[model samples]
Structure formats: C-alpha cells, structure tokens
Target chain A: MAEAENKQVIFKQYIEGVPKETDMEIKVSKTELKAPKGSGAILVKNLYLSCDPYMRGRMRDFRGSYIPPFVPGQVIEGFGVSEVVHSDNPNFKPRELITGLTGWEEYSLIQKTEQLRKIQQDGIPLSYHVGLLGMPGFTAYAGLYEVCSPCKDEYVFISAASGAVGQLVGQLAKLHGCYVVGSAGSNQKVDLLKNMLGFDEAFNYKEELDLDAVLKRYFPQGIDIYFDNVGGDMLDAALLNMRIHGRIAVCGMVSQQNLSDAKGIHNLFNLITRRVKMQGFLQSDHLDLYPRFLEDVTGYYKQGKIVYVEDMNEGLESAPAAFIGLFSGKNVGKQVIRVARE
Target chain B: MAEAENKQVIFKQYIEGVPKETDMEIKVSKTELKAPKGSGAILVKNLYLSCDPYMRGRMRDFRGSYIPPFVPGQVIEGFGVSEVVHSDNPNFKPRELITGLTGWEEYSLIQKTEQLRKIQQDGIPLSYHVGLLGMPGFTAYAGLYEVCSPCKDEYVFISAASGAVGQLVGQLAKLHGCYVVGSAGSNQKVDLLKNMLGFDEAFNYKEELDLDAVLKRYFPQGIDIYFDNVGGDMLDAALLNMRIHGRIAVCGMVSQQNLSDAKGIHNLFNLITRRVKMQGFLQSDHLDLYPRFLEDVTGYYKQGKIVYVEDMNEGLESAPAAFIGLFSGKNVGKQVIRVARE
Candidate 1:
C-alpha cells in the first residue's frame, strides 16, 4: 500500500513565560492509512482541537503533576473531535465521529480503541466537543455542583469569569438559583460576563485597585460559594470575603502558571475564621459524572437556556496563539481551534 | 434572699501581641442564683475550663468569625465540665454532671441548655470531658476521619502533635494503620509525640532550620494527610510536599495568631497542581456526629487503643498564662485549667 501524508504541529521546545509562536512548528509526514493485519487500531482525521491553559503546565517539567510533560519534537496530545477513517477494532468503524485523547495533526492512528468514545449526537457542532460540551463544560458542572454545592439564593463568585470553565460555572450557578458574580481581567471580558452570560455583577480585576475592597463592595453579606480559576491574589481576596461555612472549588490557577516565583497568599487565616472548605479537582477525576453532564448540558443548549461563547482560530497555525491567549486573558470564552470541518 | 456572690475572670481590655496576665483580672460580684420565676436557667459550679487557640481570634474584634467577641469586663465562656448546683430547666437537675459553655471562674449561671450534654460515663475522670472526651477530642476525630479521610499506610502529618487535639488525631491515625508523623515546637514535646503518642516520626519544628527539607526527609513518599493546627510557614512547607489528592484539615493556624503581619503561604499553587483538598471546620458544625464520636473515642480509650495528654494549670488565675502558652508553643498537650476538679 502507498503511504499517505499527515500534517501536524510539533513542540519545538519547552515553553518559558508566555509561549511564543516559535515554541511550536507545523510539520508534514507520511504514514500508512491502514493498520497492519493482526494490529487492533483505528486511524482518524482530526476535526477540532482544544486550546487550554492547563496545556501550559504540561509544557514545563514540573514534578508531582497529574499529566506528563509534553516532549520536545512531538505532537501535543489533547481532547479532540475526530472522524474514524479506518478501523481494525470492532468498536469504531469508518465515518464514525469520536472524541478522546488525540494528536494535534490532520491524521492519527489510535491503537487503544477503548480510550475513545463514539459520538452518539449528530446535530451539534463537532467543535463543541472541545469546548462548552466537553471537558471544560463538565469541569464547570462538576466543580460547581460536586465541590461548591451551591444552594438557592446563595451568592456565587467566579474568577476568570469570562473564560471557558468560568463562563459555564457562572451560568450553571445562575440556573441553580444563585446570585452570580464574576471577575475578569479585561473590561471587555467583564462586559461579556454581565451582558452575554447574565452574571448579576462582574468586575475587571485590572481596573479594581483593591481586590478585597472590590469583593466587599460587590458582596456586602459575603460570598457563599467561590469558583476559583485564577489563583494567587484573586484567591487571597476571595478568602477574606467568604462567609462562614463557605465552599471554594478550585478549578485552575492560570495566573500563577508561568511565574518562577508564585505569588504569596496572606489571608489564609480567614479559612479558620470563616470555616471555609477549599477543594481542588481535575475533570478527569470525575469522568463517572460525564453522562449526566452531557444529558443536562445538551438539554440546556437545545432549550436555549444556556449560552456558549467560543473564540475559534481558523487553522492549525493559529492554534499556538489561541493557547497563549489564555494567560493574557485575550479570549472571551471557550478557546478552540478549527483544524478541519467535517 | 440576700444577693448571691459570684467570682469570675473578666477581660480588662482587648489585648495586643501575646496576652498578658494583667490583661485579664478576677472580680467578685453578686448575683441572684434564682432565675426570676419564669426564666428557665441553671446555676453551676465550674469544674474544668478548655483553653483553645480559637478563643484568641474571638479576643480580637475581627469582622468575620464563628463565635462572638469577648466583651471587656465580662466573663470568658468556653467548653467546661461542670456540676449543676441549681436548676429550673427540665433538662437539668441539681447535682447533674454536664459538659457545655461555662465561665472562666469558679461559678456560672447558664441560660441556654440546648448546647449542653449530660455526662453519662463515670469510669473516666470527669475532667476528661473538658479535653480528650469532649469538644477538643471530637474536633480531632471529625477533622481526621470525615475531613481528612486518611487511608491505611498513608503518610499522615500533624502540627502541634503533642497538643490535646493533635495527640488524639495522631493516636487515631495510628489506630487506622497510617504512618503518622508530627511536628512539635520543643524537644520534650517531640519525645512525647514519639514515646507517649506512638507516632512513627516526630520533629521539633523550632530546632529544624529548614522545615521544608525536614518534611521531605521524614515524608519521603510525601504526606497524604496534614492535620494543620499551626499554619503560616508550616502549612506552606506541607503544601510543597503533599502527595496527589492529599487532604489538609485546617483546624487552626496558631503560628499566625500573634503576628500583626502574618506570614504568606507561597506554595499554594500546589493545590491546583497536586489536586489537594484543604478544608477548615469548627467542632460545633459536626455536633450531629457527637453520639457516634462519643461511642468510638470512648471505646478506643477503654480498650487502651488511644491515649491523650493534658497540661493542667491549677486555678482560674493561671488561665491567662495557659492560653498565652498556646501562641508561644509552650504547652505540651491540650491546655486545660482545673478550676475546681472533683
């Protein structure tokens, strides 16, 4: 059989501070489209790629991290939406839409068929699998419900409120009858949180001189639940304004990712005074809840009760810029890359 | 009837830095023992008083706290083991032994009986109700079991390990087959943690110049659970060396109490990277589990499976020093004042 060509983005080296375009490079290679006889594997054509802040942590050689470091000169693996072009495994067939850990390339040969899930829904945009309807959406759902445990009429505060997970968390809290508030880095993002996402109040942390003062002014009675995305100074400020028995669900710490010396939090004593419960979690840890998450979120989307925002980079070359924008708070909501359209 | 005389200790004023002996003074006053006809109340002779670090937070006029502030020239109230000398409420009878909120001096007239529990077990010393068998004991129990959820053979680290609550937590984790280690402030207390409490390892944090290095040496596999009594730097160090999904039960932060500018925790980014869960709680919040706790702890004590240590000061006059010792890490174990021991 003749070899088929594959187009891919390869990691040039480990990233430092803000990732530059030079950190990653596009490369083309040739591979057999069909798996060898007796080999159980499936070949896929990549449709969508997820651009997440957590990818930054994988770019560094950090000890005691959940995921392994992305090796230099390798295609970065992340959640992606794909179409099965050829399959040796019975579970996946030709033309079947699927989602799982896939490469940042035009084609991938996945040997572990069990790792990928066959997509049952057909009408929704395939790119949604990388954003609002995928890991970020489930993370927001699980963190808000399982960790934060919001109650009716409770005051909810979310940091990085205009980002993928944060936007979904704010909306979910609102659906649960909570009075939602959010903090974004830029004025444009703050406006998006309040106007587009229906947050009761939203603030631009950059514009707010004092975070503690801002929280106090926004939540006079104090916050009941806090969905933390940007850790560091924002987390310290949220600690001071939490009510007794308040819950803090830590989803991400995008702000402290690149700093050689992480910021110090001074107000932790408030944890004891306020009797707060601060819990950190990853979406992969709660995969059991995904089925329920998909059913509820899809229902919300179809009913028009939920709104999802995305900043879609047009091609594989723009993927690097889209991923880097997460640190500077450039993207308004879920950041995704449109590698190809089925 | 002639006015009844009452002897009590009153806070002279709000204190600064380490509380001094002169900051509080014992005063003799008169009060009617009878609850003016329709008032349901009980008069009791105080027997044992609990000197906890949480009281120090209340001593200040902090904006948000679980308990109310101590008013100037008023009796300080905390968990005490007492005998009812007189009673008008149906729940209490004269000569009944009870454990509840009581005055710092020799006598108290309690208006609320809801928070009080009748002491049924007479095999142990009645004074145990103020320490190992009471609120402090339950605080350690719930914080370790329910909050920490320690696994068998996991590395367990406890701060203030020789203190009342820490002593019980270490013993309980040992009973659950965990590899328990603790940090005390002095050589004598460190010896007690290893010898008396049966910890796998004990270190004098004061003697160790590099706490992080010390922790890494002791917990080579990393800490699975940290029972945090002294926060600030110790907590920061623990955060750096925590295993994935490690649990931190934030019962208190004694090290940061006296400082006007508390030390900042710089390694909290570990919460996200390691997916650690840190929660702060009050003993009163878990009152519903009191019966289960009482049964379990009492069974453990009777079976010789658990041991507790106490530093007893003789009179109410010594209460101030005993409490002050808590901030300085002077007391070896649970600090209790024996006002009128049986």
Candidate 2:
C-alpha cells in the first residue's frame, strides 16, 4: 500500500503557566495503512477529536499526577472517534467505528483493543462519542448521581456550567426535580444555561464580586448538592452555603489549574460545621457504570430529554487554537474538532 | 440550709484572637444546696472540667457553628465529671456520680438530666470520663473506624499526636496492625508518642519548616489514613503524600482556629489526583456508638493495650489558665481542672 500524509499535533515541551497555542505544533508525517505482523492491533482513521480542560494538567512536568504528563515531541492523545482503516485484531474490521483514547493525528495504529469501544450508532452523531456519550458525559453522570446522590427538590449549584461536563450536570439535576443553579463566565453561557439547559437559575460569575453573597442570594434554603468544577472561591462559598449533610462533588478545578500556585481555600471550616461530604472523583473510577451510563444518556438524547451543544472547529490545523480556547472559555459547549470528513 | 459560695468561670466577652486567661474570669456566686419544686432539674457539685481545643471556635463571634458561642457573663459549659448534690428529677439523686455537659464552676445547677450520663466507675480515673471516655475519645473512634473505614496493614498518620484524640487514634491504629506515625507540637510530646503511646514514629511538626518534606520522610510510602487535627500546613502536606483511595478524617484544625482569617489550604488538588476522601465530622453524630466505644476502649485500657495520660491542674480557680494552655500545647495530655478533688 502507498503511504499517505499524516497530519499530527505535537507537544513541544512541558508548560509552567497557562498554556499557549505556540506550545503545540502541527507536523506532517508519512504513514502506511498497515498493522504490524503478529500484532493484534488495528489502524484507525481519526474522525472527531475532543478538546478537554484536563489536557492542561498533562502538559505540566508534574511527576505525580492521575494521568502521566505528555512527553515532549510526541503526538498528544485524547478521547477521539475513529474508523478502522486496517485491522489485525479479530474483534475489529475495516470501516468499523469505535471510540477511545487516540493520538492527535489524522491516523493512528491502536495497540490496545480493550481500550476501544465499538460504536453503537443509533442515529446519533459520531462526534457525540467524544462528548455527551464520552468521558465528560460519564463524568457528569457518575459524579452527580453516585458521588453527590441528589435528592428531589434539593438545591443544586454547579460551577463552569457551560462546559462539556457542567452543561449536562445541570440538565440531569433539573430533570431529576432539583432546583438547579449554574455559574458561567459569560452572559451568553449563563443565558444558555438557564434558558436552553433548563437550569432554574444561572449567573455570570465574572460579574459577581462576592461569590458567597451570590450563593446566599440564589440558594436562600442552602445548597444541598454542589457539582464543583471551578473549585476556588466558588468551593469556599459552596462550603459556607451547604446545608447540614450536604454533598460537594469535586469534579475538576479549572480555576486553579492555570496558576503557578493554586489559590488557598479558606472556608473549609464549613466542611466540619455543616457536616458536608466533599468527595473528589474521576469518571475512570466508575467504569462499572459506563455501560448503563451510555444507555441512559443515549435514551435521554433520543427522547430529547437531554440536548447537547457542541462547538466545532474544522480540520486538523485548528486543533491548537481549539485546545487553548478551553481555558479562556472561548468555546460555548463541548469543544470538538472535525479532523476529517468521511 | 446555708448557701455556699460558688467560684464560677464566666466568659467576659467574645474573643477574636487566641483566647487568654483574662477572657474568662473567676466569679464568686451563692448556690443553695437545694433544687426548686417541680423544677425537674439536678444540682451537681462539679469535680473535674475538661479543656478541649474546640472551645477556641466558641470564642469567635461566628454563628451557625456546630456549637453556639458562649454568652458573655455566663459560665462556660463543657464536659465535666461531677457529684450530684441535690435532685428534683427521678433519674438522678444526691451523691450520684456522673459526667455530662456542665458549667466550669465549683457547683452547677443542671436543668437537663437528659444531657448527663451516670458515670460507671470501673476503677478507671474519674478524669478519663472527660477525656478517653468522653467526647474527644468518641470523636477519634467514630471518625477513624466509621468515616475512614481503614483496613489492617494500612499506613496511618495522626496530627496533634499527644493531644486527647490523636494519642488514642495512634494507639487504635497500632492495635489494628497498621503502621502509624504521629506529629506533635513539642519534643516532649513526640517522645511521649513513640515511647509511651507506642507509635511507630513521631515528629515535632514545629521543628520542621517544610511539612511536606517531613511527611515524605516519615511516610516514604504514601499515607493511607490521616487523622488531621492541626489543619493548616499539616493538612496541606498530608494531601501531597496521600496514596490512592486514602482517607483523611478532619477531626480538628487547632492550627487555624486562632487566626482571624484561616490559612488557605492549597494542596486540595491532590484530592482529585489521588482519589482521596476527606470527611469532616463531629462526635455528637455518633452518639449510638458510645456504648460500644466505651466497652472497647475500657477493655483496651484494662489489657494495657491502651494507656491515657492526664494533665490535671488543681483547684477551680486554675480553670482559665488550664483552658488557655491547650492552644499553646502547654498541657502534657488531657488537660483537666480539679474543681473539687474527690
């Protein structure tokens, strides 16, 4: 078989502060559509790429982290939807669609077949595999349902509400009869949260000077479940506003990730005073729930009980800007890149 | 009957900074050796008063805390061992020894018999009822076994190791066949922890400037269970050295209590990265466990498996100084005042 040009996004080096677009570069390489002999691996043609906030952590030189730091001069990997171009694995074949952690390139030779989940296309968009039905979606699902364990009519406050995970959390809690309130960076995101995502209340956190006052204003009855994504002053405020036996599900701390030194959290005293249960969790820990999560989230999407908003940047070269845009809240929804059109 | 003079410790006013001897005053008041008709109350001659670190939080003007702040000019209330001088209630009678929430005075007119527990003197020192057999002991017990749910062979680290709760936690973890390390405020306390309390290793946290480095040295292997008593830099350091699925029971934060603005905790990122569960708890939440805890601890005490150290200050007039000594780590062990020696 003749070689084809493989366009790849490569990490130049580890980052110290807020990552810039210059930190990543697009490199063109040659690839033959083949898997190694005696290797039970498949070659995949990348379709959709996911740009997530967690990727920033992998860019750091930190040794002890949940995910290992991305090696310099290597193609960064993330949750991507792909099609089998060639296969040596018995379980997969050419043109079979799957979703898993794949390289930031036009093509990849996947070695771990166990990591790939054969795509179940029930008239759903393939891009959704890296989003509402993917890691971010499952994170929202398990963190809220399992970790927070929301009760009906309880007050639910979510930070970073317009992000991939936060948007879904608000919708899920709202559907469960919770009085859902969300905080976003922009007025548009806040509007989308309240008007489109069906959140009972939404606010632009940037506009609010005092987070504690804002929380007290919206949640006069006190917050019962806090889906913490921003995790700084919002967490402090949430701690103060939590009712007795309230739960704080620590999903992500996007607010603190960019700074060289994380901001100190001061209102932890409320954790004891309110008997609040603050649990930090990863969706990977709840893998046993994925099959059910996929099924439930799929049903919600089809019945229009849940709606996903995705911001798409076209082509492989747009990858760097799309990824960097996440930190600044530049993207409106689940930030996705259309790597190629089948 | 002739009324006796009552030497009572009264709260002068709410304190913003660390409480001092002057914050409380010894006032002489008249007390009759009688109970009012149909009052359904009991009059107790206070014997021993327990000085706990949690009282510092009560000194603040902050409302909505676990326990309400002490009213100005009222006798400060705490766990105390006493002899019932007179009773109008059927449950308690004159000369009945008991331990309950009582005022820091030579004599107390207790209105609620429901709050009192009739002391079961099993040759155990009456002082133990306010320390190992009282709120602090139960706080350590319920927080570790119930909240942490620690397994055998795990690595446990307890802060404020020589304090009333920490000393017991270290011993309990040792009995459970776990490797335990403890941190104290002074060299003398550290020696007591290793030599007398049977801790595997103990360090004076004040001597070490880098808390994270000190924790890393003691726990070369990551910490599995951290009973956090001093919750400023120590809690921050514990977060950095926590193993996956580790548990941190937030028992107290005496380090942060005195400061008007609590020191910011910065290493909470480790919570998500390590999948650590940090729970803040109260002893009152586990009142049902009191009977079981008392039996188990008493057994451990008798078998010489557990030993408690008491730091007793003679006379009711010394109550203010003894209580003030706790914040400075001046007391050797469970600080108690001998209101009227048995």
The candidate maximizing DockQ is 2
Runs off by more than 4 Å, candidate 2: none
The 10-residue segment with the lowest total lDDT in model 1 chain A = A31-40
- TM-score, per-candidate, Cα-based: 0.93, 0.99
Report the lDDT tens digits of candidate 1 across residue range A1-342.
Answer: 457888888988886787777788889899787766667888888888898888888888765588889989999888899998888887778899998888888888887777687787657777888788888998999999888888999999999988889999999999999999999988888888888899999999999889999999999999999999988889999998999989999888888888756768888888877789999888888889998999899998888888898888887878888877888888878888888887
* TM-score, model 2 to reference: 0.99
lDDT of 1 at B264: 82
Q: After superposition, how far is residue B335 of candidate 1 from its true place, in Å?
A: 1.4
lDDT of 2 at A269: 73
- Model 1 docking category: medium
Q: How far is B20's C-alpha from truth in model 1 (Å)?
A: 2.9
Interface RMSD, all candidates in order, equals 1.3, 1.0
Error of 1 at A136 (Å): 1.1
List where candidate 1 sits over 4 angstroms from the true fold.
Answer: A1-6, A28-39, A88-90, B1-7, B26-40, B83-96, B118-121
The DockQ of each candidate is 0.66, 0.75
Pairs in clash, predicted candidate 2: none
